[model samples]
Target chain A: MYVIVSGAGSLGSALAASLVAAGHEVFVIDPDAALLARAQEDLGSVGRAGYASSVAVLTEAGAARAQIFVAVTPSDEENLAACQLAKRVLQTPRTVALANQPDNVRLFETVGVDAVVSKIDVLIANLAGSLPAHPLLKLMPVAAGSREVVGIKIPALSVAVGRAVREISLPYGSMVILVVSADGKVQTGQPDTVLQAEDEVIAVAPADAAETLWEALTELR
Target chain B: MNVIIAGAGRAGAALAARLAEGGHRVTVIDPDRRTFDALPRPRIDSGEITVIEGDGASNDVLEKAGIQEAGLFIAVAEQDVRNGLLAQKAKLIYRVKRVICSVKDEYLSAIYRGAGIETVNPAQMEIEQVMAMLGGV
Candidate 1:
């Protein structure tokens, strides 16, 4: 596969190196000559030293023929612009962007970028997972920023442990999808299904309402 | 009308001031608060013009500037790429009625214009004027 990676920043260079090692044709675009030269030497791929969002730069980087285009610039606007240019102008089959701001994940989608990965959101999720009091784990965003899939491990002292699924007053637009017992027995969430301690519940809810759902399910009295 | 102008640079600040003077509520966003010092103060006849110190390209900043209710959205950031993206977001995401951007890069201006956003490219306009004068057109 031919890939065009915009920005010779750490993320961009790493992606280019991995793609090159996989025997894929890769090209990197960066405005900084020093960074471009380093990326070219490290990844052994074509390097175009110019603004990635520029039509001339993209054309010179063979964006038209590239199967995939990924923008990993530090600026969300730059990433979005480069990806849009790749998709709209160059007609790249797939365009992905690393959204610097978590809020930009949906914005990137609205602008027609094929995919958006929010590193900050992932980092936040990881950080959230390390907190013992908050057992909610953000699985992934769904339906842009509107909804998300989340996992929560019910605590022993939690108010939800002894309650039925229907008894819990979950936030609006939140639904418990599935539950897994401590022994790893998976069960579909039903109104009559009683919650148990250590039960891992996977739920879908509006992204903004995830915390509310978490508090409802795991908050200890 | 509610107007949100991203970037408190010379062009953005000037546009914001003019719009505010016309009795349109204006909000200008920039990373540097000091940029607002260059803008004209609000007069008795002018509507409120708020200066926000934040990244113009940020969705939070745009929302804080009342982008959802904005009748006009303009991005005149120093970076053409930032302006293009912000203009697209204003039109597509926020559903602003009118979106305009100042793109210094002629190539980027063409792309933004093709995407249905109005773009003013000073460099392109200057080049065209120069060509017209030299060619006697």
Candidate 2:
């Protein structure tokens, strides 16, 4: 889908990366050159950037043809106006306005926006569940699921805990087994080495082969 | 007198209604159609106010909102980035006098001021108000 995003803040940048990774044509609208440059670098080959003030940004974003228009700027008012402009003026089919103020959601419904995403609400909802033990590992790209990266700690009781890479069949579709540190260091493509207890392994597998890989790697059911 | 407000949220509507009470033409652009109905009771009935639910960043909306002839342009959005963009367009492109932007973050507020846009921050104001009550001001 062709998408146009207004702003290049944390949320905007993350959303752009997520969508681009999903193979969508994304156009970013931001006036800050510094932020734009950072976004360009972060998004790399998957996306394009334009100054928010330029007529070319809107024209090239193909506002009329865009499948989704997102106004995720921090300002509730700016998001509303941008979304309104995209819909009522640019004739974009669907528009989502980010309503920062929970109380102002009523304004969203009353104002006729297609949808309103409440960041506060999302954070609140997430907190209701047991905060995942590995909070930093939250929200991996779903497409990455094709490769199916799984994190596991080797235990001393396991028979293969001290075995070398060539000693075990390992998991099915486990082409790459990377050891990531609690401190975030990564050692990839383990060719030959003794696996130690407490060592973390990130194994990748094809979608249908994850269970097989898990069983082969770990003794626990 | 014509006024163009870039955001259709509460503050923008309040300002529009206040301006309209003085008999100025007011147009507010917001993505939410509900903003039109969500406006304070007085602002909605002002008859002189026109609420166009859509983006203020769009040149078409800017033009339709009469940005060219606008006496004042106000951008009071929740996001500093959007407010700054609309301010730049209003001042540099449309040549509107008295471009007022509402910035929530002090860091962004400083940046917006450095970029030569007049800014008001409700969050800062509330903070200051609280501080004043506590004798911190």
Candidate 3:
């Protein structure tokens, strides 16, 4: 597969290296000559030192042949513009972006980027997971970001401590897939499977219902 | 009419003042506190125009600026993508009735305009003026 990568930042270089290692054709573009040269030398991918959003630069870089356009520029606007240009102008089949701000993931998706990964979202999820307070960890986005895979840990004071999966009114659109207890026992979530405090629940839920499901399982009642 | 103007640059501040002068409520939002100095002091002092120092693209900031009550949103940030994306977000999320963004690049401007948002390219507008000066060349 041919992949066009915009920006030669740490994330961009790592992605190019991985794609090259996977035997995919890679073309990297960036305005910074030093970064571009390093990425090109290390990854052996075609490199262009120019603005990612420039039509002339993108066209000259053979953007039309890109199977996927990965835009991880430091500037969110630049990333969005480059991905949009790749999708609209070059007809790239898929466009992925790294939103600098966690909030921009939704904007990027709504504006037609095929996928958006936010570094802040990941960091926040990791940080929130480390806290003692009940916080749902977003495992990943699925179903074009309309759905989310979440990990929730039932706390001791929660009302769901001893309730069966069917007994708890999980959010309307959420489904529990599996449960792992603190002592390392795993249980496939069935209607009869009762939840225990300190048990981690892995579930898929409509993104909008994730919070409600978290509250349902982890709320201190 | 309630208008939300993103980017407290000269254009945004001037536009906000003009709108507030016409008896319309105006809110100006920008991430930089220094840029707020450009705002019309009298309107800001009288509370006819509200000023907020926060990321104009953020939903919290926009809602705090009363985007729900806004009939129009104008994004004139230095970056075209910032202006266009914020404009789209404001329009789609808050259901703002009208949105206008300043896109410096003509190609990017066309792309945004094609997405059902109004875009004004200062460079393109300047070029048109220059062409008209040459007798419609």
Q: Which candidate achieves the best lDDT against the true structure?
A: 3
Error of 1 at B33 (Å): 1.4
Q: By DockQ, who's the top model here?
A: 1
Which one wins on TM-score? 3
C-alpha-based local distance difference test score of model 2: 0.70
Residue range B1-137, candidate 2, lDDT tens digits: 89988777788777877888888888888988877775666656756888887777767778888888898989987777678667866776567877889877554455456646799988878988899899954
State how far residue B136 of model 2 sits from its true place (Å): 4.5
lDDT of 3 by residue, B56-93 (tens): 87778988999998899999888887887788788766
Retained true contacts (fraction), each candidate: 0.55, 0.03, 0.31
Q: Write one digit per residue (lDDT tens) for candidate 1, span A1-221.
A: 99999889888899899999999999998888999899999977788888788778889889999999999988787888788778877899999999987877887887678888999866765664566775579999999779999999897667898899999999999999999999989999999889998899999999999999999998764
TM-score of chain A of 2: 0.54
Off by over 4 Å in 2: A1-221, B40-46
User: How do the residues A65-119 of candidate 2 rate in per-residue lDDT, one tens digit apiece?
Assistant: 9999887777775676566556655678898878886644654555466998988
Q: Count the backbone clashes (under 3 Å) in each candidate.
A: 0, 26, 0
Candidate 3 chain A, run of 10 with poorest lDDT: A122-131
TM-score of each predicted structure versus truth: 0.72, 0.40, 0.75
Q: Candidate 3's error at A208, in angstroms? A: 40
Ranking by TM-score: 3, 1, 2
What would the per-residue lDDT of candidate 3 be over residues A7-68, giving only the tens digit for each residue?
A: 89998999999999999999999999999999999987788999878778788888888789
